[model samples]
Target: MPSALVFFTELSDAPSKAQRELLTLAASIGEPTVAVASEVPEAAVTQLGAYGVNKLLVAPANESSFLDHSLSALEAAVKESAAQVVVVANDNFSREVAARIAVRVDGSIVTDAIDISADLVVTKDELAGSYSAQAQASGGVLFVTLKPNSIEDTPQAQAVSVSVEELAVSAATAPSVRIMATEEKVASDRPKLTEARVVVAGGRGVNGDFSAVEALADALGGAVGASRAATDAGWISHDAQIGQTGVTVSPQLFISAGISGAIQQKAGMQTSKCIIAINKDVDAPVFEIADFGIVGDLDKVLPQAAEEIRRRQA
Candidate 1:
């Protein structure tokens, strides 16, 4: 049977939501083989096994300093294992590595895959997520990047011994960029934006005040997001924006506060499992799609809700 190879970055403990989606995709393709870069912890390996990985391939830690070196190792492993499909988590590093690997192996590359079927037809968003496109790979090895939160997690029972392999480092042109000191952000107790099970978003209706939104998010144990209008109005940080031009999220629960829900805003979060809207205007577009609706000023409602949650927890 043909095999599928799933690539893992060093952050294996809390694998990106995209990585988990790729694992689910690999299971449907064939016996799943997980390929991890060096320095991955044993706990992560155990998690992959629990996720139905049939084989684990670990690259040497020394080979990961350069992108080309990592690709070289992965290419050798793919060829040696005869994997017909390779699924990579869609991120900056993975995209760069996948591009090089695709060129080297002469495989077809598909990015931002939302879904995959038995025939390997991959669905992806196009035109800034205004439309969807479907395509299939014809020959050689196929490479794909999975979108975060697009696939469901379904773990199965499959166990195989982990393997180690070394590939000949290929001669490549020098990269134009050099690494500099990197400062990592301090971790937060709130759920990660992309991986959060629930997300609370604020908008222009909040009148440039995000205190209530932040409080509600903290009470709910979710990340805080904002609409483009709110960000453009300087009510919230750009990183908090969520719309056609902003971050896309598909969480199990999404709560919107004082958001009018433009089409652009809806496009990014329409896929959320459940939606709740808190806006003073009952006719707001946001209320149309909300599973639950509260028509009131968010400033008044948020504090009470937060206090209730805190009281319950206490």
Candidate 2:
């Protein structure tokens, strides 16, 4: 059978949902092996092994270690495992790491692949999720970064003896970029905007009242998002903004309230499995692409939707 490799972030007691998605994708493609540049927890090791990881390569870790510093260790793991395909999450960190690895391995690269077949063909969005195209590896090894929600992260643990090795990193392999400081974001119980299965976004129609957006998001167990206009108007943080200049998302469901659905905004979330737009303007651009469009007052529409969702769950 072909072998697949996955890279993971070293965070928490277990792999994050994004990392688990990589693991699941790897297992589906071939024999799965995982590489991490941090101290591996026994629980994490056990969990990954149970999820069909045949080997786990742990790179030496430091307080400020970054992905660039781990490239040498990762190169060694890829060579040793002889993996044909490598998988990672669709994020900036992974993209940088993949770019470096592609050069080192003389490999073909693809990012934000929405689907990958067992034959190694890749399918991803193009023209800002307006079209989908198929691609194949032309050289070296196959490397792919997957968008969140492209695969389910359910673990398929089996009783297997997974070989765990600690990779050595020589000082010569130090990264070019040195981190002077690190600032962590404030922790939140809510799902990450990019990774959430459902996202509820607000725009100028909210008139600075994000209460409806927050409540609807809370009811749906999703993350809150915002349009560039909303963020520029200071109704929400810029990080929550969804547009060409902000984070791109591919959630199972996206609810847009008051957003105009300009090309910039559509670039960020046009790939969502289901799109519902609520705008008072009958000819709002957002309604053109929405799977369901409602012409009404958003404050009233959102509250009612949230109530019904909660009542159904209850």
Say which candidate scores most in lDDT: 2
CA shift at 251, candidate 2, in angstroms?
Answer: 0.5
- What TM-score do all the candidates reach, one by one? 0.84, 0.95
For model 1, how does the per-residue alpha-carbon lDDT over 1-314 read when each residue is reduced to its tens digit?
A: 55888876564576655567787789888878877666667766666766677567766554324565567657876776688888887776887888788888888889977787766788888754557899988887888888777778776665444443444444445634434555678877877776677799999888988988889889888899999988999877797888778887878889999899899999878778799999999999998889999999898998998899999999
Residue-level lDDT for 214 in candidate 1: 88
lDDT of 2 by residue, 208-257 (tens): 99999999999999999999999999989999999899999989999999
Q: After superposing candidate 2, which stretches have Cα over 4 Å from the reference? A: 157-159
Candidate lDDT values, in order = 0.78, 0.86
The TM-score obtained by model 2 is 0.95
